[model samples]
Structures are given as structure tokens and as C-alpha cells.
Target: MTEYSRKQEALDYHAKPKPGKLAISVTKPFTTYGELSLAYTPGVAEPVKAIRDDPEDAYRYTSKGNLVAVISNGTAVLGLGDTGALASKPVMEGKAVLFKKFADVNVFDIEVDADDPADFIDTVERIAPTFGGINLEDIAAPHCFEIEAALIERLDIPVFHDDQHGTAIIVAAGLINALELQGKTLADARIVCMGAGAAGVASMKLLLEMGAQLDNVFMCDRRGVIHADRDDLSEHKAQFATKTDLRSVDDAIAQADVFIGLSGPDTVSKEQIATMPARPIVFALSNPTPEISPEDARSVRDDLIMATGRSDYPNQINNVLGFPYIFRGALDVRARRINMAMCVAAARAMGELARQPVPNSVLEAHEQREMAFGPDYIVPSPFDPRLIDYIPPAVARAAVDTGVARTEYPSHYPQPVVETDRD
Candidate 1:
């Protein structure tokens, strides 16, 4: 199908089935008078009073424990750039759908038209009582960092910017498996990151937490390398700034063990890929189109492992693999925040899941005959049912271990479901 045809189909899918992609569904029946009374008025007031007396009781009596608020200011809707809040509704709703389908978590997509970071943070903090967790989406960098940090400090519930941590977690997981496949270690890998925005910065930080050395990592923004010499750097970007002589993507990619591209399409050339070290790993994760196409990268060196944001390619490093499961675990444990421990734990769980035997169901979903812990299969399929069972437990345990959990870990996690799983 042509691009125009696909675009039309997407519009039809969203428009034809009602005006939007999501709607509210009442969990309790309210057919009879007694049922209606219990759902509202007198019975509801009892729980309200109980929660007033002990705020923790709100989780027991209300949907707050299972509810996640997907809030976005829409300053940066994916690669679209500053599309504004109303324009980002569909993407937020799509995120809501993923939360429900992947982890059985409930999401209310909230789009706030606040341009100021302070206003966005305040708006989210005011509604903190209504949600178990907040998934911050599509707010641009520098401000996004400020918004998330301020909210995390102010709110007791978990506030995670999926654009930063979600992308980071999945990238770390896939990079772990890819490094293993190439017989390389994170500590030793000479890394080149081609974007200094949210995902690029966060992924590098997470890697540092996971044992990647600071000096081994080189970050690049549009203004070439993010080195110490650059004066016009945001505080977030400054964290990754190295005192390097390397000034260009070409200079950084030379002899690098890993090349991570979170930048625009076709920014990397086949010549750059050829300059990388033997058995290198490249994650060209720019959406729709990657910094370097998989074919172009592979044509230069067959020994290299490649991953992209596009699902049509092998070893796609998609954020869907992280956010749903991460939030599921955070909500399950009543985590005060999504700490680095939780993020690392989730990444470790995903990396370990990749090494396990591929279920026949997964192979069939991808229309493949077989799959294993190889170059092409470094990340678990998003449809893998085991993710619900595997990720949340690890994350919850990490939360408990890190002393961020408000409640004890549940004995019965990921309760069995009847629905058939698909990728």
C-alpha cells in the first residue's frame, strides 16, 4: 500500500469507531437501585470518609491503585515536534490502549495545554491523588527533564516520563543482549550516541548505572559532539558532556563498539558503519526512518548487529517493551517512584527473557519458524505473555529493595488471564 492509502486507513480506523480511540467502562454493575446506591451516594461516601481518615485506604476502596494517568503537554509528540496538546490526543490515546492491552493497566489520557514547565508540573501534581502512577509523555527536553524531576520530588506516586526512561530501559535491555551476542561488555564498549535529547541522555545515564564507563560514551546533538568545550548546553546535556577532541559523528563512530541513534532519519552513512569496531552493535532508533537504514549498515559489515525503532526490521528497540510493564510493576508494588534500581531491574528482566526459549506462540505471531538468543532476537517480543509475569515481579522486587515501595510485594502476581496473546 502507498503512504497516502495507509494514512487514510489510520484516519478511518480512529474516526469511524466513534470519534476517539478510548472510552470509560464501568467496572461494577449499576442496573439495580442497590447497585446504584453502592456505586455512588451513601456507599461511596463511606469509602470517602475512610480515605479521609487514612489516605492509604484510598487504594483499597478506589481504583487509584490500578489507575495510571498518561499526562502530556504535547510540546513534543514523537518526531512531529511541538504539535501542541490537542494535536497529541491520538498518540496519548494510543498509549492508553497499549497500557490496557499489554499489561492490563488502566489509563486515562490527559492532555494539558500548559506551555510552561511549572504550569505542567503543577497541573499534574494537583491531580496526583486520582492516579496510582503518571506516565509523562511528549513534553520536549530540558523542560521535560525539569517537569519530571519536579513532579517526582512533589508527588508520592510514581511519575515516569516514558520518552526518557521507557526508551532507555528497552535500549539498555537490547544492548545487553546484543553485547552478549558479540562477546562484549558494557564497561568496555566504546559507545557513540547520535542524539542528546531525552532518549539519548537518559539511555546513556541508564547505561552508566548499568556499568558502562563515562569516558567510553560519546554523545552528539545537532551541533556535533556534546563535549566539555560547548558553552550552550542544557544542564541535562551537560551531564553527558565529555572532554573529547572528537567533533563529528564520523569521528565518534570510528572504532566505537556501539552506535545509538535517537536523531533524525538518514543522518548516518554506510562509511561510518564500516569505521566501527568488529562485531559492533548499532541501534538506529529514529522513528519511521532510522539514522542509518539496516540494509545500508549491513551492506558495509555483515558481522555487526543492528536494531531500529521500526518493527519491520529485526531486533526493533521499541519503548512499548518497557513502559507498560514498568508501570504495571510500579502500580503493583505501590512504588513511591520509579527509581534507577527499578529501571535497571526491568532492563535486566527483559534481557534475561530474551535468552530464554522462544515460545511457539511468539514465533507464529511474527510468522517465523524459529527464534533464539541471536543477533536478530536480542529483545523479547512485546506480545510475549511472559512479560507480564516476568517484568513486574523484578521491578516490584527492585522497588522493595530500594525502599521506594509503600506496600509489600503481592504473593499472587500476574494472575492468569484467559485471552489469547499476540504481538
Candidate 2:
């Protein structure tokens, strides 16, 4: 068998056979030729005319209100880094599926292979009219920052880079809940972030916005802690550099109230985790492999509240838990932009949801589940149905109240259809 056919056979047997990864189903069906003419050509002219008369009604008449485009140039495909467009299809498709599963939003994952940033931006901009919002996924940092900023400024619809903002929002939410559970405040906590990459920088910024003391934050890259003296730090890392003379991860780790790892595997030693202050909140958020395994972390520090990007852990600080609901809120309000205020609002909503009494349904999901909210249960499980019903509405209200929303929808959304028939 040919290699392509062999691969296709495996995918067909193990993946596509389970209902195919995606399907383009009709929204409003046109079974008859008369209905087809009405829906496609002749009668569709009336709605087209109305939309032309009032452009805002385009959202009302078309799928634009509920459709989002997951656009990426494949410069950074997850931790697999800089894998180019064709290889990034699976990840983008996964994101599209997540949007559909979580918020009932229809999504098209567009993987573009543009050699130039301008071409990529222009491409997205040209297609902006068809989507309610644009989700920039897995694009590389520095460039992603520039792309997101320019697009948000140019497009009327909300534009978000899920890697930077989404990861930051969810991490901030987890930190908020962890600190609250530990009876600590962000302003007083000594936060040491490992990895001054896009997500770490954004997380630090969110924490700062939420009252974290800048002086107390120690950002570390591969070389160790980021200081003004460090010549190797990225421009994003320089912004978070502290005045402290501490030059290594060990020093920062010894005094830290929180250890946030966005770096690679085995970067954090057990000795450093052990050196953290009593009840230290450690979010080791490296992907398939964390900076320190939860078992090893818990083995070293009895008082540590540990979380990772992995699902098997007690607290999985994944962006999937944040962006779908966040965009749902933004789209609901027809938000023009996603500001720091909206991000803070999302973090607060996530934290508050965790503070509430755990529902029996959620407790049942956990194997060692208990009806309590404490160290082990700092953040709400992603499966918590409250994410859809609560968090997004809070964000929408925040967007509207902050004057960022271009238009506002009704407060009440119909109960979502949890089950879908695979055609």
C-alpha cells in the first residue's frame, strides 16, 4: 500500500470512522427546487437587499452572528513549534470542534501558508465580513502580538490570539482561585514565572492588572530569572524584569509564593519546589510534559497546590477551559475588542464559579471527588456546565458595561442543545 493510502486507512479506521472529523451540514434546509430557489437565489434577494440597506442586519440574516473563523499561518502549532500550515490542520480543526462543542458556534478552520505577515493579515481581513469574530490560534509570539493588535484595530469584529490571551486568562483564573483557597492576595504573593514566552508575559500582565505587585514578580527564561542585566531576554520578558538582584531560578524559587512554569520539561528541580514557602501555589503548565510532574511536586512539598496543562491532574489549567466561553461572551455582546477589563472579568467569573459549592454532578465526575473546594480543587473542572451558563454572560455584561461592545444581544440565551445527530 502507498504511504498516503496507509495513513488514510489508519485515519479512516481509527479517526474518521467515528463520524468523520467534520461535516458541513445545512442550517436551514432546502429540499425542494422551489425552496432551493428561495433559499439560494430568488427569495434570498429580499434579505440581501435588507442587509445592504442596513449592514448591521447582515448579522441578523446570515450565519455571521454565530460563525467564527479559526485562522492560523501554522508558524507555531502547539508545543510542536513552527510546523508550517499543512501540518497544523489537525490542531486548527480541533479548535474548531471545541468552539462548536462548547458554545454552539459554527467554525471554519483556515490554515494559510502565507510567506509574509502582511499577506496573512490581508487574507484574514478580506474574509472578515463573513465571520462574527476571528480567532488567531497557535501563531508564533512577537509576530502573533503584532498580528492580533493590528487586526483588532482594523476589524470591527473581535479578534483574539488564543495562545497569548486565552492561556493568560485561564492561568489568571486558576491563580485567583488558588490564592483565594490559600487565603492569600495577589499583591502580597511572590510570583515567580518560569518561561517568559507569550503566554507567561500575558499571564504576568493580567496578574499585574489584577493587583499583583510588579516588584514581587520574578520572570525566568532558559537562562534563569529575568533581570535588567540579562542580555538574552526577549523584549516581552524585559517588561517584567524586576529590580531584585536575584539572578537564578533557585533564588526566586526559594522565596516564591507561586511557581508558574511555562518552560520545558525537567526545568524545575524538586529542591526548588521544596524551597517554596508553605502552601505555595505551583502551576507547572508545560504541555505533554510539565516542568515538574505533579507526583514529584507533591512528593517534595506537602503544602503545594499543583496544576498542569495535562488533564489527568487535579487542576488542569488549559486554555480550552477559557477561550470558548470567552468568545461566546464577546460574540454575544458584538464586542469590538477584547480588552484587559474583559480578561479580568473572565478571570473573576472563573474564580467565583470555583468558590461556589461543588455540584453533585461534578463530584460524580471525579474519581476521588469530594464535595469541597480547597487546595486540590482550586479551579472548576472544564466539564462544569456552569461555564456556558455563567461565565460568558458575565463577560458579555463586562464588555457592554465597558463600552467595548458594538451591539448587545438579549440577556437570556436559549438552553443549548447538548446532543447533536451525526449525519
Candidate 3:
């Protein structure tokens, strides 16, 4: 479809399906006055008094164990920057839909109109009791860092900014497989990352946590390669700043083993891809259009293992692969917070899944290629049903092991499914 047609179709889809993308549904029986009284009046009051006596009973009596709040401000929404909180509702609702569909997690999409970081932080903190976990979305840079830090510190629930860590987790997963395919290692990989915004900064940090050396990862924003001498760097950007003389994206990518573009379309050229070392991995993950098209990159370096944010390409590093299952695990175990161990476990599980035999369901769903554990299939298809079993368990195990879990490992999970059906 043409761009205009696609836009019109999306608009019609959202509009025709009632008004918005979400609605409330009563979980308990309430068809008669007897049920109504039990649902709201006397029966509800009993649970309320019980919860008052023991706050932990809220999970037993309510949806608090399963509900996640997909909250956002309008800033840095997709490629459409700073559209305002009210305008961000649709995206937030769409996120809620994903959370529900992919992992069976309930969500209330909250759009906070506050522009000041402190105001937004205070607002979310005040409403923290209603959710099992908080999925922060679309709120922009330096402020997003502050907001997430404060919330994670103050709240006992898992507070995550999916824009930062979701992208990072999937990027980490895909990078793991790509590096393995290319006979490279994260420890030795010379990395160049463009876009020092949420995804860029977070991906670099996660990579560091997962064994990538600090000195080897060179990060570049629109202002060029972030180096120690750059006095204009924010705290997050400054964390990744290296003591290197490299000043441009071009300078950073010279002989680099990996290039990750969370920046805009065509930001890097074919010339830049050609300068990279043998069997280089490039994840050009800007939405709709990538920093350099995979076709352009491959035309120069035939050994390129390329991934984009588009499904039309090989190894699309989509955030859907990470967030749903991560949250599923966190909620299942009643984890206090989503820590680096849990994130790494999720990434490792994803990478391991990609190496396993493809199931027929996933093969039929992904028609992009004759699928296998190869360069084109670094990460398993997002539709792979095994993800629900594989990733969440890994995350839960990490949560329990790290002592953040309020409960034991979920009894229903790690229920391994035999995938005998494959092409």
C-alpha cells in the first residue's frame, strides 16, 4: 500500500473499532442485583477490609497481580516527536493492546499532560498502588532517565521504560545471535552506536552489563561521536563517552564489528558500511525507514548481517520480542524491580531460542525466508509461541535468584513444550 493509503487504513481501523483501542471489562459475575451486591457492596467491602488489614491481600482479591499501566507523556513518540500527552493516548492504548495480547497482562494506558519531569514523576508515584508493574513509554531523554530512576527507587513494583530497556533487551538478543553467526564476540566486538537518545543510551548500557567493554563501545548522537572532550553531553550520554579522538559516525565505524542505528533514516551511508570489518553486524532500527537500508548496506558489504525495525527485512529487532514476556515474568513472580540480571536472562533466553529448531507455526507465520538458525534469523519470529514459555521463565528465575522476587518461581511456568512440528 502507498503511504497515504496505509495512513488512511490505520486511521479507519482505530476509528471504526468503536472510538479508542481499549475498554474496561468486569472480570467477575455482575449480571443480577445479587451479583452486583456481591461485586461492589458487601463482598467487595470484605476484601477491602482484608486488604486494609494486610496490603499483600490486594493481589489475592484484585487484578493487582496481573495489571500493568502503560503510561506515557507525548514527548518522543515514535518518529513523531513531542506530540503532547493527550495525542499520545492512541499509542499508549496500542501498547496496552500488545501487553494484553502477547502476554495476557492487563493495562491501563495513562497519558500524563505534565511537561515538568518532577510533576510527571509525582503523578505516577501517587497512582503507583493500582498497578502490578509500570511500563513507562515515549517520555523523552534526560527527563525519562530522571523519572525512571526516581520511580524505581520509590516504588516496590517493576518500573520500566520500554523505550529504553525493551529496545535494549531485543537489541542485545539479536546482537548475541548475529555475533555468534559472524564468529565474533561481544567482548571483542568494536561497536559503533548512533542516536544517543533513549534506545541508544540504554542499549549501550545493557551491552556493558552483558560483557562489552566500556572503552570499545563508541556512541554517536546527532552531534557526532560522544567523546570525553565533549562538554555538552548529558549524564547518560557522558556515561558512554570514550577517551577517543573519533568525532563522527564515520570515524567511529571504521573497522567496527557492529553498528547500531537507533537514529534516523539514511544517517549512515554505504561508504560507512564498507569501512567495517569482515562479517559485520548492523542493526538499523529506526522505524519505517532505517539509518541505511539493508539493501544499500549489503550492496557494499556482502558479509553484513543486517537487522532493521521493519518486518520486510532480515532479523528485525522489534521490542515486542522482549517487553511482553519480560513483564509477564516480572508480574508472575511479583518482582520488586526489573534488574540487570533479569534483563540479561531474558536476552540470553531469546538468543538461545533463535538457535533452536524453528517450529511450524512460526515458520508459517514468517514468510520472509526459508527460516533456520542463520544470519537472516538471528532472533526467533515474534509470533513464536515458545517465547511465552522460554523468556518469562528465564526472567523469573533471575528475579528469584537475585532476591527481588516477593514470591517463588511460578508453578505453571517452565512447562516445556515439545516442538516436533517444523518445516
Each model's TM-score, in the order given?
0.96, 0.91, 0.96
Could you give candidate 1's per-residue lDDT for residues 248-316 as a string of tens digits?
Answer: 878889959999999899999999999998999999999999998989998999999999999899998
RMSD vs true structure, all candidates: 3.9, 5.8, 3.2
State how far residue 205 of model 2 sits from its true place (Å).
0.7
**Alpha-carbon runs more than 4 Å astray in model 3:** 415-423
Span of ten consecutive residues with least summed lDDT in model 1 = 414-423
> Between which residue pairs do clashes occur in model 3?
none
Residue lDDT tens for model 2, 1-423: 999999998677547546435668887867899989988788999999999999989878889988899999999887898899988888888888899888888898899898477888899999999999999988877788778888988999989888888989888878877887777888899999998777888899999998899999999877887887767766788898778889888999999999999888878888889888888999999898999999898888788788999988778887877889888988887888888888887877777777678887787777555756677777788778888876687778778889988776454864332211110
lDDT of 3 at 20: 85
lDDT of each residue in 7-123, candidate 3, tens digit only: 999999899959888888988887999998998877789999999999999899999999999999899898999999999999999998988889999999999999999999999
Candidate 3 residue 29 C-alpha distance from true site, Å:
1.9
